[model samples]
Structure formats: structure tokens, C-alpha cells
Target: MAEGQRALIVSAHPEPTSFQAALRAAAVEELAAQGFAVQVSDLCAMDFKATLGPEDFNDPRDTTRLNVSLEQRHAWQQGTLAPDVAIELDHLLAADLLLLMFPLWWFGPPAILKGWIDRVFVSGAVYGRTAVFEKGRLQGKRALLAVSTGAPSQSYGPHALNGDMNDILMPLHRGVLGFTGMTVLPPYVAYHVPYVGPAGRAALLSSWRHHLRALEHLPALPMPRLSDHPDALGAGERAH
Candidate 1:
């Protein structure tokens, strides 16, 4: 909402002409009009390597042995991470608002987006032992998920066949975004996307633009703070 703020949209739709792509493009235009410097990571266009393995590291101290986590930490320290990961990190660090735009697949993000998180949210760099939760490296940043679902909104309720949308997104909003100290905003979901008529799609895009216009005023979803609880695992059990 602030003038000259930087926004990064990580879009994972494979087809350029898809509805997801149209929403993403609309977001760019709207946000830019609101004085945002926008950048997009079109994952499919980039053909981003979704899997992490030994190849991610150029040189290993012990070539015969490999621990992915340890290797990631080492890479971060040495500034030797994969070039793509490094670029993404730079973009993330510079962003004030981060938008993850994708069509929900099996009640979650696409595999390509998941892999981007796995590789780019490096241990030592984005998070670490003491720099997590309330003290995370990305504490001041905001993240919102702009998601699309093939099913109708009615099917996503608590008792619906598709289960609750909020429950399905908890792992991402709480475990991932909140864990990293981002202010997780309530998601914007467009349901029954494929079945929607042209008018419905246009309305959804209009809603998205309105949402962006008031982004700074939107309340962040509540998240538990690590500091609010005791360090001991069974503290609550002991109290009870």
C-alpha cells in the first residue's frame, strides 16, 4: 500500500494462457498502479529445477558423504549456493510483500512451488536455531497466498467433501510462513475456477484488485508466538 514498495509474486502456473496466469498479470498491473515495484518468478517458464540433490552443491568437503541440510548451511556460509536459489533469495529479501500465486493441486500448492520453497528458504540464511518464529530473519515481511481451486466454495467447508480450506492451508500459513516470521495474511481464493463463466472470472479479477488496493489495511491472520510458550516440550502437560 505504501508508495514505492517492492512486491514479488512467485507464480507456478504452467500455461501462459491459463486463468492463473491472467490473475497473476492483473496483480502486477494493479500493484504497480498502487506504486509497487513488482517482480514475478514464473516457475514453469524458468524451468526451475524442482528437486534438490548433490548437484546443487559445486564442491563438497566430503564428496562421498552428503547431508542436504548441512550442505545447505555450508553453501549459505560460503556464498556458493546454486545460482538460481541465490537470485530468488535476493528477490525475497528485497520484497516488502510476497505473493504466492498458483492453482491448488490436491488441496495444496503445486510441486514446483513446494520445491522452490525447499531450495530457496535456506536454513542459515532465511532461518536458523534462534532466528525462527517471532525472531525469524524475515520477521517484518508479509506473505499472502492467492490461490485458485477447481472445486466450488461450498465443497471446502468444515463438513464438506473437500474438507476445510483453512485447515488444509494451516501447514503452509502457520508451519511455513508463520514459522519464518512473515505476517501471514488471510488467503484470497477463487473457487470453481475452471467452471466459472467469463463474467465470474472478471469479477474474481476485480475482487483481487480491490484486495490489493487495501493490502496495508488487511489484518494479519493470528499465529502463535514461540515466545508465548515455555521452552520445555511438556510444559502444558505439566500445568494440566
Candidate 2:
């Protein structure tokens, strides 16, 4: 049992009655049962700001210019980020496991969740020079995505019309989560959710519960390590 461990569930769905919400609830209950203290961020219910803008930084490093990345690093270091961003950052840093629950839209996450990444994953706090991939600030943490898709399961298969689901999710898994040094667990996806009958929905929930029970043993998806590409480090330095 992971007693005293913390889990953060960030749920993005406009409707509280949606399957995404149900998944979030199930995660909370199961994590709690596993002796984890769970924290929830219901973005829609909270009316979370879905944009990254100047307001996110109270003290800009340059008054005449607005470089989002540089400003994020500055705000993070100065402890002057917007309250909502700061609060979420705290939860993120404190979590042992982070679960992002949302419906797949346009082959990606919703705009709100993207905004959360933009605002909370500050440049300095989450990643910076030499602090990325295996050396990321979140290196010891784990992240999982619980997603619901409108398309049927077969459509997401390797040669299906819609393309492989893993490929579709590679950007997020590798670019965002893995880039920050979090171990990316294989995502849990419920396909054709809108068309699934009640029995199917129940079965998905049951499977999700089972998956959560074995979270600790789940194998991480492959991610690139900076050490493997020593040349990349100099390239990274040049880019910055």
C-alpha cells in the first residue's frame, strides 16, 4: 500500500455527468483505497482559464517584451506566477502520480488541458537547460492519461482509417509528459464511449479499476534519454 503517497487527477470535461468525469471519480476512489491521498482539479467546474497570457506573469523580466518561456521562468523563480497556476504547480510537484482525464478531441486533448500545461509546466520549474527528459524536474514522478474516444476501437488500430492511437498520442506522451521526466504509463482509453451501452460502460469502469490496482507494476512507455545522445546536450545548449 502506498500510504502517504499523493495522486493528482486533472479532469477536463464540460459536463459533470460525462464518462470522463466518472473515470475521474473512479480514479479518486481507487487511489484512495490504495492508501493514496488524491487531489482533484475539475477544470470545467472551476471555470479554469484556458489560455496562457500576460496575466499569468505578475512580474515580467522585460517590460518592453513578452517572451512566454522566459517570462514563465522568471515568474516561477520570483514566486510571482498567477495564483491558479501556482496552486496547480504545487499539486503537480507534490504528486507521486499524476492522472490526466479527458475526452480525445481533434486527435488531442482539449484546449483547457493544453492551457494547463502551458501555464503550470513553467519553463524553469518543469524544464530548462539540462533539465529535460531523464533529467527533468518531474523525473521521479509518474503520469497516466485516461482518455475516452468517440471512435470505435478498431478505428484506432494500426492500419485503421483513423490511424494508430499510440501514434496520435505520441506528441503528448513524448513531448510533454516524457520531456518533463515523468514516467509515462500506457494510457487507458475507452473507445466509442458515446455509443457504448451501459453494460459496456460498466465494463470499462471495471477494467479501469483493475488497471489502477496495478498502477505500480505497469511498464513505462519507452522515452528518449539525454544520456544516449550526448551530442544533443550541446545542441540543446545552443538552442537555449
Candidate 3:
């Protein structure tokens, strides 16, 4: 492991027997092999809370005092979050490369992970003129989505019911993580959960290792600074 570089792997699966844990172990091993420090937060094991409250905003528990600020209120569209989210807020601030490992529950993150986002990706920490991602506080930082899906990849197509897996997780990519300033790399989705046996799991982790190796030499995502904020350019001059 390196002296300062650390990767935080946050897993949100309830069952330790799950292949999700295997995926996490694979990522940790791969990162460690590259001499990167690794930290795992088995959120379910930690008994993570899944609700939000008023104190989360540093205000009294008015039950309706979500108005921490305009930005906070703006995010109320996601609903109120629990106060314990402060703990996650701290962890996120310290991590460099964050790996979110979870199962795709009903086409999205588990309720617990969503709550973590709700609480930790708070108004002040995640938004403002000067934010972690607002102006690139963590511009060089990276995030990867290691998700497990019960449905097959074909089922996630345009005509299928699952919808585009990438689109389904846009909240993590473009909304919370990217909006705060992190560069989201291509997600690693393990589809067809039912067919994932021990051998299949091994193959998945092997592929995961290959992906990690491919990224080992690259320090971070390749997005340009100005490109980080598409809205930064003039309305008429900004190109797609």
C-alpha cells in the first residue's frame, strides 16, 4: 500500500455470503497488488441506517427544517435523510478513489446506499460555489460503480424492461458523485445474477482484475478540467 493514497470500497449487501463480497475482495486485492491502500466499509455489517432527519442539517429537529440552505432544500426532492449520515460524510471527505459495490435493487442502489448518499452527499459538503466536485476540489479523485444485477444484460436494452443500466444509475454518476466533482469512470456491471455461480463469479472477478490492471497505470479519469463543467462555457460556444 502507498503512504497516502487510499481507496475506500463501500459495499451495501446484507449477505456476507453474497458474491458481492467476492467482488469487493477482488477489487481490494487488485488495488493492493498495485500498492494502493484499501479500506472496506461493509455497510450492511455496520448496520447502516436508511433514514434521514432534521439534525442532519445542523438544525433543530423541526421535522420540516430541511432548509439547511437553498441547495439543501433543492435536494429535498430526494427526501429527508438521517442525522447519522455525518459519519459517512467524514469518510467520503478523506477517501481518494471511492468504489461503490452494491446490488442493483429495483434498478437502483440498495435503500441503505441511497440513504448514505442522501445523508453524506449533503448540501454543504457536496454543493456550493466551492465544493468537493463543484470546482474540482476532488477533481482528480475517481469513482467506480461495481454493481450486480439479477437481470440479464439483454433485458436491460431499450425494448426490455430493465432500462439502460447506465441510465438507471445516472444519479450516482452525474448527480451526486459527479455533481460534487468526482470523475466517474465506466461502471462494471455484473448482469444475470441468477447464473453467477462459483465459476461465473471467479470469471467476473478475473475480469475485474483485468479492468483494474488496465487502470493501474492511469492515475485518474481523462476528463479535461474545463470539460468537467459543461455549463462553464458561453451558451452559444459550448460544444457537446
Candidate 4:
């Protein structure tokens, strides 16, 4: 919470005038007010390439073998990662807290954000054999997902039609962020966004502002210990 601490918000909405964009804007303002040096990566605005291919690496070990993870790791070690990936990695490494803002598309993040993770989170640079989960490369950093959903909050639960929101988010929270050694915060969701009126939207924005202001006191979602899952380690496991 120190003055000038950095916060990076990765916004994945395609429309500049969308509600997701407004939420991203609100986050930037609130974090700035709280003395954070905010940086935003508006994926759509940047026209960020979401696909990972040979172009992302400078030199491939075997031109015939197209292994993304291997190439990404090699690129990092050789300081030859694609410019975009390198830049994003720099932002992530410098930030104290990283927020991913996007609309929940079919129970997951937009392809742009997913692509960001695929390219920027290089295997050797970010995580490796022993550098994951509790001992991940970015161990001390924090991450949060601020998402919007079309369904009402009541529609999400163990038995509900949309299923549990927390369960739906476990992939990003535990598999992605936790695997990278970040403390994952509970998601801030703006549900039934299309149905909410101005006042409701305003209320949600207000709550978002409050959340950022009190980030230091917010409890991180509990993740299983490395020892808890010796079989698969940080791989697929049931949400706790």
C-alpha cells in the first residue's frame, strides 16, 4: 500500500464504450486515488495478437518441432521473446497487484486475456519444475479477476443453472494465478450487467472503488498447499 506502488489492469473488452470498459476505468481511477501507479493494457485497443505461434520466439530449437512451451522458455533465457510478450512481462513483474478485467465469456475469460497468459507467462521465465504454486516465480505478487456476467448472481451456485461462480473461476484463480505464485483474491463480479439500470451500475462501480481502496485488508482465496496435492501438483484438481 505504499505510495507509488504499481497496479496493472489488463482489460479484455472489445468495445471502448462497454460496461466492462467503464469498470476498468473506475478501477484505474480508484487505484490512482489510493496512490497506486496504474498501468492499463487494453487488449482490444492495442490489437494484441491473441494467438501463440512461431513468430513469438526468436529462435526455435527445432524448426520442425513446434512446441510452444519449449520455445517460450528458450526465448526467455535467450532474451529473444516477442516484443509484446516481453513488454507485458515487464509490466507484470513491476506491478504489486495485477487485475484482469473482462466479461465472462461462456464461464471463462475472453480469448485475449487467455492469450496474454499463454505468451507472456513463459515457462522458464515465469515458472519451472520447482518454481510454481507456493514457490512460484512471482511468489509475493497478488492477482484479482474483475469480471462481468450476463446472468444474475442468484443463478450461480452448486445447484443453480449457471453453476457456482467460484467453481467456474477456479481455473484462473488456482491453475493460473496460484500456479504462478500469486495470492489470488476473490473475484469482483458485476452480474446481470445488461439488466441493471444506471443506479445499479453506479452501485456496482461504488463497490468496485471500495474494493480497491481496501485491497490490503481483503482476504485472499485459500488455495491448497503443494503438499496437499502430491499426485498432480498444480495440475487439475477440484476447487477447495
Give one digit per residue, the lDDT tens place, for model 3 in 170-224: 8778776776788777788888866877788788888877877776454443333
Which candidate comes out best when scored by lDDT? 2
Alpha-carbon RMSD of each model: 4.2, 1.5, 6.3, 4.2
Cα lDDT tens digits for candidate 4, 1-240: 558689999999999999998899999888888888999999999999999988776677768777777788788888888899999999998998999999999899999989998888889877876677887888888899999999999999999998999999999999899988999988899999999999999999999888878898899998866666677645553363
Clashing pairs in 1: none
Tens-digit per-residue lDDT, 89-198, candidate 2: 99999999999999999999999999999889999999987888999999999999999999999998789998999999998899999999999999999999889899
Candidate 1 lDDT, tens digit per residue, 1-240? 458789999999999999999999999998898888999999999998889888888976558877776788899889999999999989998999999999999888999999999999888877776566787788899999999989999999899998899899998898788888999988999999989999999999999888878788889999887778657234323231
Q: Pick the winner on TM-score between candidates 3 and 4.
A: 4
Task: Determine the C-alpha RMSD for candidate 3 after optimal superposition of all C-alphas.
Answer: 6.3
Per-model TM against the reference: 0.93, 0.96, 0.78, 0.94
Candidate 1: residue 176 lDDT (0-100):
81
Residue 77 lDDT (model 4): 82
What TM-score should be assigned to candidate 1? Answer: 0.93
Scored against the true structure, residue 39 in model 4 reaches a CA lDDT of 95
Whole-model lDDT for model 4 versus the true structure? 0.88
